[model samples]
Target: MDIFTLTIIVSIVIYIFIGNYAGRSVKQIDDYFVAGRQAPTLLIVGTLVASVMSSTVFLAESAFTYDGQMGPFVLFPQMGTVGYIYGALFFGRYLRRSRTTTVAAFFGERFNSHRVQQAAGLSIIVALGGYLLVVTQGAAILLSDLTALTYTQSLLIAWLSYTAFTLYSGSKGVLLTDTLMFLLFMVATLLFTFYLVSDLGGISAAIQGLSQLEHKADIASWHGVIGAGTEFPTAMDYLIWAIIIDISWGIVFAVSPWQSSRHLMAKNEHVVLRASIYACIAAGVLQVLIYGIGGFINLANPDITPSESAIIWAAKNMVPEFLGALLLAGIMAAALSSASTFLSLVGFSASNDIVRPSSPKKTLNLRATRWIMLAIGLLVLGASLFLPPSIFWLTYFVGTVFASSWGPVAFMCIWSKTITASGAFWGMISGFFLNVIPTALQYLELIDLPSYMDPILIGAACSLVVTVLVSRCGHVSRQEKVYRMRLHRTPAGERDLKQTKISVIAPAILALYGCVMAYLMVTFYVTPYQTASGQLLPNGQVDWATGEAFLSVSWALLYIPLALLTYILIWRSYSPGAKNIEQAQTKA
Candidate 1:
C-alpha cells in the first residue's frame, strides 16, 4: 500500500516539475490561448497526444478492449489519425486563414455575425465539458480501482492537480506535463503489453484458450443477441460501424475545436502538420498496445470488468512485486496525461469560448481565465462522480455531439463561402439538438430509438439539410459565394498557406498509413470486437506470419520525413502574398 501511494506521489511530483519547466511562457493572451504559436513540432505532438487521446484512449479503450474487441471503438484510434490529418491538410489552414482566437470567434469575424459566434461557442462548451467529464471520470475510476480512495476523493485530486498546473503556465504547463505523461504512459503500457502477451505463452496458447471459451453459453453471434444491454455492438455490426462512423467522425471531429485547439497552439503552420501527423500515429500505437494487453489479460482471467485493469491485475497476481509497481506507475501516467489535456480544454473553453474578456489588462484577464479553469475543474470532478458514464459510451456520445454541431458548421463555413451566419447557427443548433433531444427522449423513456449505433449520422444530416435549405431560401446568392472566394488580403503572417511546410508531408504520410491499415488489416485481434456473446475476448494468440502482411511496426514512419519534405516543398508548391497564417495565429 505504501509503495502504491509512493507511485502516485511520484507521478504527481513529475507533473509538478513539468509544470514548472513550462514557466516563463505566459507573458501574453496569445501565449495563454495559442501557446505563443511558437511551440516546436515535437512538443505540439506531445500536447496533441496528451489531449486528444485523453482518458478515453487510456481507460475507456482498455475497458472496452478488456471485455470485447475494439469493436466500433477502433474508430477511436483510427479517427485519431484521420482527425489530425484533416486538421493539418485543410482545417489548420482555414483556421489560420480566419483571423480569430477561438474557432467560434473566427465565424463571427468572417461572416460578420455574432449569432454564429454564440452558436459555435455553445458547441465548444458542450464538446469541451463532455470531454473533460470523460477524462475526470476515468481518473476517478483509477483511484477507486487502485486504492481505498472514494470516487469523489480521486476526482478532486485529479481535477485540482490539473487545474493548478494550468493556472500556473497555461498551455506551456499543459505541453510540458503532457509530454512527460505521454512518455511515461507509452513506456509503461508497452511493458504491460509485453508481459501480459508473454504470460499467455508466446500468444498461441492464448488464442487456443480464447477459442475454447468463445461461446461461454451466451448468444453465438449478433444474429442471436441485440441491443446495448445484450453486449454493446455485435461483431459484424461493430466492424461496419468501425469503418463508417469511425471514418466520418475521424475527419469531421478533427476539423472542429479538438484538434484545432492544438493547431492554434502550434508554433507555426508547419508545426500543426508535423504534430498532427505524428500524434495520429502515436495515438494509434497506444491504442493497439493497450488493447493488446486487454486481450491477453482476459484470455488468462476470463471475468474482467469492461474497464479492464488486467495489466494491474496480472501484475498483482502473476508478476513480481517491483514490476507490478512499475505497471501501476504507467497506468497513472496514462490517466494523468489525459487529465492535463482535459484541464487545458476546460480552462481554454471557459476563458475563450464561454467568456471572452475584452478587458485591456492582459495580466488581469489571464488571471481571471485561470480562475475560471479552476472552477471548471471542480465542475468536471462533480460531473464525473455524480454522472459516471461508461468510457466508450461517453466518448462516442461526445464525438456525436461534436460531429453534429461543429463538424457540419466548419465544413460549410470553410468550403461554402455563401454560408450565412444564421444559416450556420441554425444548422449547428438543429444538429446539436438532434443528439440532445434523442438523449433526453431516451432518458425520459419517451422514444424508442433503436440504438446509439448512429446518433451522429442523424444529427449531421439534419444540420446539413437545414442549413442548405435555409441559406438558399433566406439570404445567400451565387454572387456572394464567388465574391467571398476572391482572396481578400490574407492575415498578417500567412502570405501563402499551400507553400507552408504542412502541404508536402503530412497528407502523404496519413494517406499511406491508411492504405497499409486497409490493405493488411492486422491479424492479431488484441481487442476483440464487442458482440452479443457476452463480450467474449479473442482468447487465442495470432501467429504474426498468419496475420495481414501490411501491418508493419513502422505504421506511419514516413510522416516524420514527410513533414521534413513539407518544409522543403513549401517553396515549390505555393505562392507568396496569399495567406498569412502566422500573423493570424499570432494575434489574439
Candidate 2:
C-alpha cells in the first residue's frame, strides 16, 4: 500500500479501537443511546462538526465552486456560521435544559401531544435516510475514481462494512469513533492542504496572480461588472428565497430533533453551549479554507468546469499519491462519520416514532431497537445499490424535504411560544409540499427554476403566522397560554433576546463578515485581474482575492475572548447541576 492508503487504514483501525475502548460500559439503552450522557464538550464539538462538515462540503462544494459566481459563493459560509449561531443561542441550551433524550421528546412535552413526537421522529428518519444515501453515493464515486474498484463494488463494500461496524458497537461506538475520525480527518487534510498551498507559490504570490486573472473572467457580468448573465449557469442565487425566507430551516437544527440528536449526547448544558460555539468557529474556518483552496487551485490551472470537480481534480494533479490518499481517506472519514450518526438517529426514531408506539409499558425495548436499526440498514443498503450515482443532487432533495416539513415546525417550537400542535401540523405539511415537491420537480426539469427560494420563504413565513393565528383564534390551553404570558411579562428576557436571536457574538461576527464581504465586492467591481502577458483569462482561471486566510485569523481573534466567557458561565451552571448533568438538569 502507498503511505497515504496505509495512513488511512491505520487511522480507521485506531479510531475503531478507541471506539471499542470508550464503549466498554455499553450494558444498557442509556449507554448505547447517549454515551451514558457522559460526553465532554470536546467530543460534542468534534462529533457535531464531523456530522455537519461531511463529504458534501469536501466533494460537492469543491465541484460546484467552478461555475459559481464566486468560488463556493459567500452564502455557503454565511449560512453555516449563522446556522451554528442560531443553534447555540436558540436551540442547544434550551434542549439541554429540557433534559430530553430525543428532540422528539422536547416536541412531545412542549406541545402536549404524541403527534409532535411523531413529527420529530419522522423528520429525523428522513434526514438519516438521506444521509445514508449521501454516504454511499460519495463512497462509490470516490472509490471508483481513486481505486481500481467499480462503482457498484465500492458502494456495496462501503455499505456492508459500515453495517457490520455499526451493528456491533451501536451509538456508543458511533460517538467515540466519530470523535476520533473527526480529529484524524481534520489533521490529515489540514496538513496535506498546508503542503499543497506551500508547493504552489507562497500565499501572497498566489493571490496577486489570481487577482490579475479575476479581471478577465467575470461570469455574472458580461460587459460590465453587474451585467446579468444567462439562465441556469448564470443565475448565482440557486436558493435565494430560501436563504432569506426559510432561515429557520437552517437555524432550527442547532436544537431541533435532527440537530439536537448530537447535542443531547453531551454531559450537560455547559457542554452543549461550548459545543455550539465550537461549531461556529469550526464552520467559519471550514468555509474559508475549502472555498479559498478551491479558488487557489483554479488560480494555478485557470480553466476548470462545473467547479464541483475542484477537489477531485486537485487530488489527481496537484497532490502526490501519498498525500492524495490521505485526503481521500479524510473524504471517507467525513462520509462515515455523518452516515453512522445519521443511521443511529434514524434507527432510534423508527423504533420510538413508528413501531414502539408510546405506552406506559415503555421499556424502550433494547432488542426491538436493534432489529429496527438493522431494518433501516437494509433499506439504506438497498437505496445505495439502486439510487442515482450523484449524492450532490439527491441529498439536497432529501434536505429540502426535511427542511420544509420539520423546518417550519421546529423553528416555531424553539423560538416562538405561541405555536400550537394543530397549527404546527398544518403549516409543516404545507411547507413540505411547497419546498420539496416543487424543488424535486425542478430537479427533474419538469419546471424552470433550479430551487426558487420563494416557496420556502413563503411557506415558513405562512406556517409561523398561521400557526400563531390558529392557536390564538381557537381553543388554546390555559396553562400553555399562561406560561407564554409569564414569559412575555419578563420583558427583560424578551428585549435582551429579540434582536439577537443568535448570541451577542453573532452580531459582531456578522459585522466583520459584512466588512470583508464589502471589500471583496468592491474589488470585484473595480479591478480586473490580468495575466503576465496581459491576456484576460477565462472565469475559472480568475479568482477573488484571498479573503479566507484573513477570515480565519479574524475568526480566531473573535472566538477566543467569547469562548473564555462561555467557559465561566458553563462552570457556574454545571456546578449546581453536577454529576448526572443531563438528568439532573432535566429534573431541576
TM-score for each predicted model, relative to the true structure: 0.80, 0.79
**Local lDDT at 215 for model 1:** 35
TM-score of model 1 (CA atoms): 0.80
Q: Which ten residues in a row are the worst by lDDT in model 1?
A: 217-226
Candidate 1, residues 374-486, lDDT tens digits: the string is 78777777677778466766667676677787777676665665577678879989989987777556556676554344656678888888888778766765543433453
Task: Give model 2 RMSD, 1 decimal.
Answer: 7.1
lDDT of 1 at 218: 22
Off by over 4 Å in 2: 68-77, 212-216, 219-249, 300-309, 356-358, 449-453, 478-588
- Please, what is the whole-model Cα lDDT of each candidate in the order they appear? 0.62, 0.60
lDDT of 2 by residue, 1-588 (tens): 555446555665665666666556678777777777778877887787777667787878555444433322432335545455456544666555555667776667667667767766776777668777887678667666666778888777666545555655666788777777777667767876687768876654554455455643542231112224533442335335324423543554454454567766777554566567666666555655665566667665756664555776787688787777777788778877777777778887787665545665766856777788899988988887776756666655565455556655665665565678777766666665666666666778787653344445545566656666776766546664543333222122222222223333434454455455445533432233333323343753433333333332333344445444453443333343224232333333
Give candidate 2's whole-model lDDT: 0.60
